[model samples]
Target: MKVKYWTCHSDGCAANVHIDKNDHFIKSHGQHHHIPEPEQIELRNLKGKVKERVITETSSITKIYEEELARSNLSSTALTLAFTAAEG
Candidate 1:
């Protein structure tokens, strides 16, 4: 499955937002703050400082996934069974 995400450009804010495929907000880091206006939302190529923020957010997502997996009791076998059940 493909997961969608949003990365905002704001200083001291490494807010990596995970969203549903339909663009519905799922979760985020940094702060539960409101999103900026479209004009305020910086749109630029990944370079220098912006690149650093991207790397940091990527690492944060990895950590979050690891924590979630550890807390969940489902094993690989159980996940397979669940997928099969859903498919049927």
Candidate 2:
């Protein structure tokens, strides 16, 4: 393919930038093509990872927690009282 594929070097840009093999710029397409600050991209990625991990782990444990809760004989009031006593 003689087409040179290019993308916005910006972290936040979802734009498609293209060029020809002849070193001629083809076109850059997007409503927003501004570059994101370095720290912002780092933080944004970190937050996304954390959120993904949390959702994954939570989904894995949710069924286990629900099963245990269902098997328990203790009422909500009794559980609360026990928890309060344990805290003291």
Candidate 3:
């Protein structure tokens, strides 16, 4: 079975997970020292959805993006960051 390793994004954090070919959790290591950033996680997921729609659908990218953002309840900070990332 194929294995994939997922590592923490935070600097100096050791938290990680191992997954099998089917994306089932195999094991985990370490722990996060800080509180979870749910908004950031949500924003990341929203971006992924928008990207998938952009790739598979024939709709205008602006329309796809507007629809996704409209459905999501991301914080002002997250929305600002998303637009900034898209602009840059």
Candidate 3 local lDDT, 19-84, one digit each (tens): 998999999999998888777787889989999999999999989988998898889988888788
Over the stretch 22-79, how does candidate 1's per-residue lDDT look in tens digits?
A: 8888887666256664322211211223345546676564454444335445546544
Order of all candidates by lDDT, from best down to worst?
3, 2, 1
Show model 2 residue runs off by greater than 4 Å: 33-88
Clash pairs (backbone) in predicted model 2: none
lDDT per residue (tens digit) for residues 1-88 in model 2: 4777766566777777678888788877775556444544443444455455557676644454344434444455544543454358
lDDT of 3: 0.89
Scored by lDDT, the top model is 3
- The alpha-carbon deviation from the true structure for residue 21 of candidate 3, after best TM-score superposition, in angstroms, is 2.5
Query: Against the correct fold, how does model 2 do in TM-score?
Result: 0.31
Candidates 2 and 3 compared by TM-score, better number: 3
Q: In candidate 3, residue 24 scores what lDDT?
A: 99
Residue 78 deviation, candidate 2, in Å? 64
Per-model TM-score on C-alpha atoms:
0.33, 0.31, 0.72
Off by over 4 Å in 3: 75-88
Report the number of clashing residue pairs per model: 0, 0, 0
